[model samples]
Target: MSTPNDNPVPTVRVLPETLHRAAAEVFGGAYLIGPVTDQMWERSLPMYRASLVQGIVEDDGVVGGVARSWEVELDVPGGRVPAAAVSSVGVRADRRRRGYLRALMQAQLQTTRDNGALVAVLRATEASIYSRFGYGVASTYATLKVTRRRAVLRPGAAAERRLKMITPEAAVRELPAVYERIRTARPGTVSRPSWWWAGMVDRHLHKDRPVWVLCTVDDDDQVDGFLLYTVNNRDGWDDPQQAVVEVLDLRAVDERVELALWQAAFGIDLSEHLLAHGRPLDPVLDLALVDPRAAVTTDVEDETWLRLLDVPAALSARSYGAGEPVVIGVDDQLMPDNSGRYRVSTDGVQRTDAEAELHCEVGELAAVYLGGTSFTQLAAAGRVRGSSEVLARADALFGTPRLPWSGTYY
Candidate 1:
């Protein structure tokens, strides 16, 4: 028989409900996002309980690492598929280099796959860690800073007398219905569960700093668009001009409604500048400004990192553009069942005997899967191998009318 020191083994298991708190402590401690004490966890209990967790339990019964996921649906090009919203993943501080994280991730992937999720999506705390697990930077967003003094709305930008201010409590009650109706299900977007509204929005507005909400009403008295923002007062109360208005969440049913909401924001008196985080790569603010240069993009970063759990199901779920069919070979090391050449056509995707014209690893495939990046770009970067003709065909097949964007944050 081998001794304990011969070669240690790490194992991950589907933790029962009682260990949820233990797993959450490990996750929160790893990210330094929580003191995760008994009281704090109880206050945020509903949201914590929303996810199914897999953990590495140590011999002493302290959870060492965890991978937690929520059941969500991620929109693809022209369709949506069941998705695992992977979040709160972490390894204990003392558990470094013990292979606990790897085991937890592998177990989470398999468990999520077996549970019928076709894809997994996450917002990475560290940019470099998840790629090795076949997660790719699938969608990106930019932080936009608009100079309020220089910003002017053109004629017809807003419906006169349509903007209305509402209390935070009202926002919690009403905005979820508005969001469900207005959200167009763009590729990379995920459905917001009830817990999302409660935790991400309601709890913050009620428990944290003062937040403001504005709504635009239509002739039918329906809320067509809304903006959620917070004000950062300048150094001194006398220096209101230097204050900054930060847009937290804004959604509109259409372009006109969007511009109307921004127009109202320009009317705020305390701030000379406004910053909107997680704005799409192409924001209407750039064009909505009278002087387009007044709205500047400060930085662009990855918004969603995606992993294909069931490649065939994911490939078939999204609608494709008109292009000649191409056999693309995808190699997934973590989920070997996803490795195969798939014939992609407007009709659908299917495993095929035909030799692949384009070849890429699962990470590269995930990058182009959502139609945000073109095959040609990845080919030029050497992540994709294909002839010019095949690349062009793949690009056309995956092209979307609007770029993929996920407006919500976990």
Candidate 2:
């Protein structure tokens, strides 16, 4: 193990087979999972080989830390822009708090910038760790639980759409196009590369447990939505009647199609309750149900954490609301190049030397970049320093028509 005095610098390189195994071991140890097998490593190696993997090596030539990033196109206000999706971040237990995390993050940001990605996004394992690195909560998700007794669909719900249960193989072949249609129109959604699809398929097709996929088709014989879910037999031998239906993934082209899918999910026979995690905050099921309270939101939490690597590039890529230009000062300690005054309006954005009406850290700005939160709320929390007039102007400039949500997890 490397001591605090050893302080080794992290490097990005083609990991050798031994180091790859060591990295996997460290990751499993950190997460308290079983030992990673050779079979598992070989199966996932192709995906990792395609990503940007970095690690900190000790003087004894053992891997103590690892992080990875993949390229993705994130949907912004006006259009989609290139983004870096970060994942698999971990450090060996023995090597914690020796500045390794800080170094790894700095290197990751610089590498992401070099790849010309405007922003960096991740599903943080801990909410408190990434803010110091200039990342902020950009989107939120809700956990839903609804009793089967109260799952009746409201009158006039879409009944014309045809629903069919399909094999997972069929779903893998047909669902991407349908998902793309919905993802393009939604803010905060990101492109799921082929490797991501493979991983999802592998996860659901585990030998011990299997998942089912259902599709909804329009009259024209085209699929408009898909839902992947699994059923759990809660009561073993005593009461076999109790079961739960858990939704793993769901996507639809429109509300009508979404309602059809939810109707099917709630209609699963013998299931006492329907549970879904990481669903959109504003779900259509809430309005589609006869009793709106049936689909209760048990928890709401941050989904996507965003970091603006290139502030100018990120700010200018998205279109603003119709409002007067606001001169805001952004304090980016990690990236000094981003520390400046920016004039943002519905027209465009430009760096200026003019006095700033509002001042905030880069992370605070990222929190509102997707329009999921408002500047007024941040000001009330002392996150943004400005007057009421400027706060309202900032809020108006960043407001979005729909609540921002990222349904995909990396």
Candidate 3:
């Protein structure tokens, strides 16, 4: 094991292979695993970027590392724009608190900016760690635990569509169209490339051989939505009645199809409970349930963390609501170029020489950029500093008609 003081100022390098190995090591340490294999590394390489991979070397060995900026389009408030999805961030167990993580993050942010990505987004391993790096919770997800016995569709709910149970192979071939149709409908969603589909989506689907893929088709026989799940049978186990139908992935174009999918999951025989994890904040299931409490939302968590690398481009990409212009001062310590006063309005965004009505960090701005949280909420938390009138105006301008949701996890 390496000690922190062995190499006080660790050397940083961009080594894709070394970073990949070090990442596996960091993850093994993080998850209490002894080691990770090359096969695992090969499987995840589709999402890996050699240029974006950064590592800290000690005595010619990678001691800490991070990978990021997977080129992808993110659905912002009214439009889709280029974004860099940061992931696979980790540090060696023995290299903690040595500023390696901070150095890597700083380098990553600069690389993300240089890549011309308007925004930097991540699914944080630890919520507390990213906030200091100027990443704020940009989207939220809800976990649903529904009691199967009480999970009944509302009387007037739309009749079930043409649902077909297809093989995982078919699902891998067919579901991308359905996903593409709905990916941009919500803010914070990022496009899933073919590589992502194979490496992440298909890999998971193939893991559980008995996995069920239910596709919903329109009258014209066009695929609109799909549900990927598996059932646990505990016939000989102690709690025979405790079988669960777990939802691995569920996507639909509209509520009707979504309800149909939920009904199918609930209607699974011998399953006493239906659990859906990482669902959007919208309570479509709760509203469809005969007993609202049947689909109990056990937890809600931050799903997307966003950092503005280029404030001007980030602000300009998303459309704002109809409101008077407001000049807001942004303080971005990590990327000082993003620190400036910007006048935002429904018309557009631009750097302003005028006095600022509000002041906030880049993270705070990102928190409200997607319209998931309002300026008032951030102001209440002391994140946004402004007068009452300015806050109200900023809220109106930045707010969205629908809540921003990132349905896809990269």
The TM-score leader among the candidates is 1
TM values, all candidates? 0.95, 0.94, 0.91
Tally clashing residue pairs in candidate 1.
0
For TM-score, candidate 2 versus 3, the one ahead is 2
Where does candidate 1 stray beyond 4 Å? 1-7, 159-161, 202-208, 234-237
Scored by lDDT, the top model is: 1
Ten-residue segment with the worst summed lDDT in candidate 3?
1-10
Per-residue lDDT of 1-410 in model 3, one digit per residue for the tens? 23365545555666656456676667667546557677776766655643366667677565665555577788998888888887767777776787778778888888777878888888877788998889989889988898888888987684559988888767767677668875546788887776665665555544553577888888888777888887666452356367777787888878878888888787777777888888888767777777999888868999999998889988998998997999999998888889999999899999999999999999999899899998889899888899989999999999987778876776
- Give the lDDT of residue 226 in candidate 2: 86
In candidate 2, which residue pairs get closer than 3 Å at backbone N, Cα or C atoms, i.e. clash? none
| Cα lDDT, all candidates | 0.85, 0.84, 0.79
Model 1 agreement with the true structure over 1-410: per-residue lDDT tens digits: 22244435577888888888887788778988776777667756776677888888878888888888989988899888999998888888987776676777888889999999998999998898998999988899989898888988777765554778898777877888888888876898888877677666655655555688999888888898999988776453467666888898888888778888888888878788889999899887677677998888978999999999999999999999998999999999999999999999999999999999999999888998899899999999989999999999999998887778898898
| Candidate 2 least-lDDT 10 residues | 233-242
Stretches of candidate 2 off by over 4 Å are 1-18, 234-241
Give me the displacement of residue 129 in model 3, in angstroms: 0.1
Estimate the Cα RMSD of every predicted model relative to the unseen true structure. Answer: 2.3, 2.5, 3.1
